[model samples]
Target: MAATVVQLTESKKHIQHTHRVFEEQKKAFRSNTMPSLAERQENLKRLKRALLTHQDRLLEAIDRDFSCRSRDESLIAEVMPSIQGINYTLKNLAGWMKPSRRHVSVLFQPASNQVHYQPKGVVGVIVPWNYPLYLAVGPLVASLAAGNRTMIKMSEYTPHTSALFKEIIEATFPEDLVCVINGEADVAADFSSRPFDHLLFTGSTSVGKMVMRAAAENLTPVTLELGGKSPAIVSPDVPMEDAAQRIAFGKAFNAGQTCVAPDYVLCPSDRVQAFVDEFRSRFAEMYPTLRDNDDYTAIINERQYDRLQGYIEDARAKGAEIIEINPAREDLKDGTRKIPLTLVLKTTPDMKLMQDEIFGPILPVVAYGTLEEAIHYINERPRPLALYFFGYDRDHQRQVVESTLSGGMCINDALMHVAQDDLPFGGIGDSGMGHYHGKEGFLTFSHHRAIFTKQKFNSGKFVYAPHGTAAHKMVYKLFIR
Candidate 1:
């Protein structure tokens, strides 16, 4: 077992490296406790320049990692969002860094109060395989803008992209200021256990539990971007074509490997067939062929491919109707790992597809008798990371918004809410917790330290020692009511 010995050696090496780098980052952060706004903006600008300079290489690495990842999809989903996020951070970081002044009460007229957004010492970002570049860059932008040293752990499944990212980051930033760590599961576990001021993990809910538990050992604050079965609700009054097209895009983009992708659709009972037909039509228009189409993205690996295929088989065995929308009718079993948009009808709660977050190009359309029933169905389950409502009726939209709870919601669109730089992205309950993006992202990695100042006066001394004194009684009588 020479391979086993080699693997053990590599694991030990990675663990030791992680420990050393972590301590170095902590020391670096202590040296420069608070970086000026100009420094943070310059860091963002350098990051943006690096991403643009090596754009082609980054795309090629992602394509190689997936075996058949779409070049255009990489640009649209990964590169564009990353660059935009950095620009957004650069433009707004100055305002975000300014201390927020608080109003002092009349009883404390001689004092001033404010909150300084100080950087937490160092931040740990664990990136997932799907959309690795964007996920890593998104959190990294926020961490840098908040003036903290960062250590990124890239997914081992995407070796090509992960290695390339590490190279790019090393060339652009110093080890103590920023570093990238790459390894397998054991390495990830070790990386998670390292003490950091804050940690942000983006991955599956099951694995999220392990990361959170590991972080708990050090009482590390974490912002988990976990995924669940995000759903899209189609209103009876909304046009089937519009709803179907948007949902199809959400499900087909990157082969539905997105965390916020619409996992299922709750369509009106009588319109289920119509919605299916429209969805098929729209998806075909986008991807006429699967096997040879460079526009279509393949699953990351054979294991993931098998897992998706197993879901389809399990649903079929459970009596669900499986509809494959392969417009060209090509044989996709050529080991390309490309899966067409497969729709499941009449899905039962017992099926694996319904129980788990289907993170592939599989959409399950469940029929609901009424809007109330649809709301009831979603309310019964764990709150999703994102919920999409496709309808034009103002009253119905309001009803859905007021009735249910989710981490984020989009009206008349799917997956676009995440692209908006102004909004915060996060989850609730089992889906995930903690917000990031824009100001929320800056605040997530920062500590709002409250400060109170007084000069040549001591208003608080009146109530300090003698609680029954006249000054204390007057102060209490003036404010306690």
Candidate 2:
């Protein structure tokens, strides 16, 4: 089925609306002292309150957007993580904002130095569609916590949810303080061109580049949360059933629309059948029937549906065997229908699935005879956003950890590693350019200014330029490297 092209008029109305909102917020930001720690706490509390009030809508919109997002999963995965992030920021904001006292060497004892943390003037955050609420609000909360005015661009793919989000925000915050723009991709290009003190983007690597290039025109600093081919390694030592359950949950969650969803899997060749059998059984148990299974989400839109469909057809054409796990249902509908979850076997490196990030309900099993082959295979690809190793062998886990590089690690699990707000979450290289979550999220939108305050006595006059030869000699001996 073909997708209906959604056209965006970067019409004068959009430009005028955006400009008026951005300027008003810019004025508000300039006039307001970055919120005090007390104010930030109040803001976080308000945000949490708003979410709690609107939790039902969030669940509905997310459910509507993805055919099968569980309310429990949304609350836990999206809502709670955001709350925890807010709480973490509240607990640490004071210390994070405090000026740091720097040591004054004996030779420069008269001078006292410090560093002041300040917010960026204005920030632009562009969110992806998979986890719209969390993706938009997480950074927005952090930006607000850091005392910066912000503008957000929500994915058009999630228009209903995005519009609802805007309404919720409108109820809580002044448009001058924050604005949510929802339109097609071209509007996103326009949003990126807006002058921003700092810009953060979460999406594919290709779009990240376009955002970066657009920001470059204004010399704006950018934090890119890009996607890559993240890998998961299932060690032979782990309980086969347990490993399969955890892997299957991560792969199937959100219909595998997550940025850090394990793009591929590696396991010992001997254990491959057991793992596959377990995965199939566990997935079936989890989703006894796809027709009424609310836990299974649909492809975001037809374009992605077709893109994934193409990847599937290409892989099948190239001789890869696909296991159709989607139960045969009499109710299977048209284009927006659910594509079957496929487990690919005997996959070659040259296959289409292996060449790109498979952001769908598809998992490819690449078996290795030895651990070194797995390590080599992982290293050969760009470092992934997240890496999973399912085993109880602490020694092997540590060895893999030491030998390989990834943005974050889940020793015995998968995607849930991101839900821990206590950790810094972001990817590396093609995966992402920087981290944000918890305090790191706050820090990413701030500029730390180092300072010095000397006593009125001016004892540091000794370090001034009118020095005699003897004074210079003494200063060099005591302070110069």
Please provide TM-scores, in order, for all candidate models, with all chains considered together. 0.99, 0.94
- Residue 370 alpha-carbon offset, candidate 1, angstroms: 0.7
lDDT of 1 at 333: 92
> Candidate 1: TM-score?
0.99
lDDT (10s digit) by residue, model 2, range 293-353: 6666778888888888788788899898888786544354564457667898889878888
Which candidate has the top score in TM-score?
1
What is the overall TM-score of model 2 with all chains considered together?
0.94
Model 2 score (lDDT):
0.84
Residue pair clashes in candidate 2: none
lDDT of each: 0.94, 0.84
